[model samples]
Target: MITATPRPSATPAHLRDASLVDPLRVRRAGPGDAAALVALSEPFVRAGALRRRPFDVYAARAADFLVAEEPGGLLHGCLALRVHPDAEPGAAAAGVLYNFCVARQRQGSGLGARLLGAALTGARAQSLAALFTATTGSGRLFLRHGFAPVPQGLAPRAWARTLDPRRGARVLARAL
Candidate 1:
């Protein structure tokens, strides 16, 4: 139920026409948001920017997601943080960030940053030791947020096994 503070109006000149809405909120995703989450991720799936995930996948992992929503309940973006399953009790957890996407029209309006902030906050709340993400494109956004390029082998084994080598994904990590 953490809410983002209102964004400033200091948008870059190129994005002056951006439909940057105020009062945006980031919250934990619930079962009811499954469809919207799928819809939000569809374009990325088609573009191969993200792997396709069925509605049932979202439903089953709903608690692992965070969504950016407008006052009227329209979803603006979504991010998922998957905690690695521990091999033994009391081991510190690691996490994988995936399925991050922003509404096409809102792409340059800072919604991604808001959603990322919320997800990171949630990760810290869960006491994760570090977070990892794989990106097919540039890792600029994640780098700016403190992530550093790392060998794929450094990722949690369960998560690394899920990566597709053909995707040429660059692995990045940030310790909490």
Candidate 2:
């Protein structure tokens, strides 16, 4: 069984109180959640909201993810905090937050915020010096969470190499 570390209930003042409508519980993704994670991410992939990652990728990196689940094992959202492969010990670790998705039905709800908060908390716990991400649309949610737009050249080389210029993804980063 995968255990989740409970995060503080404090919500960012800029965001709505999603807990008032439907509270969320965020937890680390376990082996069993692979299929569910892929299922939740499919719609975003189809809509071009996110890149398509194979099942093997999700399975291999399950430990790097955090999921927001509702009562009765229903998963509402998920995100991945991928640490830079070249990060050296004692140096500021770098990571990228990617594959973030919330169910279409629950988009307006607070599940996204809860999931993001959990990811940030996880990054902090890991002592990451910076977190980065790419978005194709307006980045209001990320901006609200302290992320600022940055040039693609400033992103980690590995991440920047994966960018498809045609998609026009805007890179953003936040220093911890």
Candidate 3:
């Protein structure tokens, strides 16, 4: 298992105190974290809540992702920021958040909100106007954080898949 360096809690006390979720240490992901990342994401991948992405892809894109590691070096959750590095500057600085999963034992423990905050912080730093994601569950969480459903045709292929022909997806975006 990959170990995560400890850090102060990433979430504020108010949010942490109000929920059943525990605190987490959020950090940038590294190549050594690929396997853990894959494992953390499997449940969603199998349920079609997340796309089938390979471990190597996580390693390759480690620079664009973040992980919430518990004190013991175990990965509780992850969130990735997807965007083309060379895309036009004025195009709203788009990003799609993917592979966000909290360990089964840690679900509902404020870790997801902390991860989302970190990703949104990264997006704003990159001059992104908004951050987007698709959720099969937790629509309320996104809504609580100011995300709203985006119209069809506005999302990319990966994101559009969230809107499957068999079962529709819920798209949400938050302006940074």
Candidate 4:
């Protein structure tokens, strides 16, 4: 039999009050944010909703991330947009969204939607031809944001090549 340990929630106790909906500003992440990124995504990783990634990887690719932050340096959410050039047969550029996470206290308060919106805006800013993401969950948020079901082959070839078969993630795409 396997036993699981009860880890303390990453959310601070004071922030758990459901009525407290503080303003969270979404911004691009920097190299110094690796530790917080790992902490913010740890629960999702443990829940099997996200693939586990190391601190070094986050640090190395910090520019690909966007984080939701409140005053006093608290991070409530994060998402990564990895731009893939030479993505398709015709040399179309695209972005692959990944590592999306929100603190439990911030979920359902439109923070997730806000993050997705920011990512879409960023993709547009970069003039990406399309945006793609793979999700193991219901993907209702992505669907609501105009991402529809797509074959893995439709995603950026380099990204699709790296997907783990065992994770069974469904690919979704939306044109920019």
**How many residue pairs clash in model 2?**
0
C-alpha lDDT of all candidate models, in order: 0.89, 0.87, 0.77, 0.92
Badly placed stretches (over 4 Å) of model 2 are: 1-23, 85-90
| lDDT score for candidate 2 against the true structure | 0.87
User: Model 2: per-residue lDDT, tens digit, 1-176?
Assistant: 99999988986675555665566688899878999999999999999989899888889999988998877888889999998854455667688999999998888776778888888888899888889999998988999999999998767789889989999899999998
lDDT of 1 by residue, 1-176 (tens): 99999977786776553244356788999999999999989999999999998899999998989888888999989999999966668888999999999989888777788787788898899899999999998877798899999999988998999899999999999999
Which digits, one per residue and each the tens of the lDDT, describe model 4 over residues 1-176? 99999998798788865336556788999999999999999999999999899999999999999999988888999999999997347776999999999999979988888899999999999999999999999999999989999999988889999899899999999998
Best by lDDT: 4
The order by descending lDDT is 4, 1, 2, 3
lDDT of 3 by residue, 19-87 (tens): 346546789999999888888889878887877788789889887779988678899888898863324
Q: What are the per-model numbers of colliding residue pairs?
A: 0, 0, 1, 0
Global lDDT of model 3: 0.77
**Candidate 4: lDDT of 19?**
34
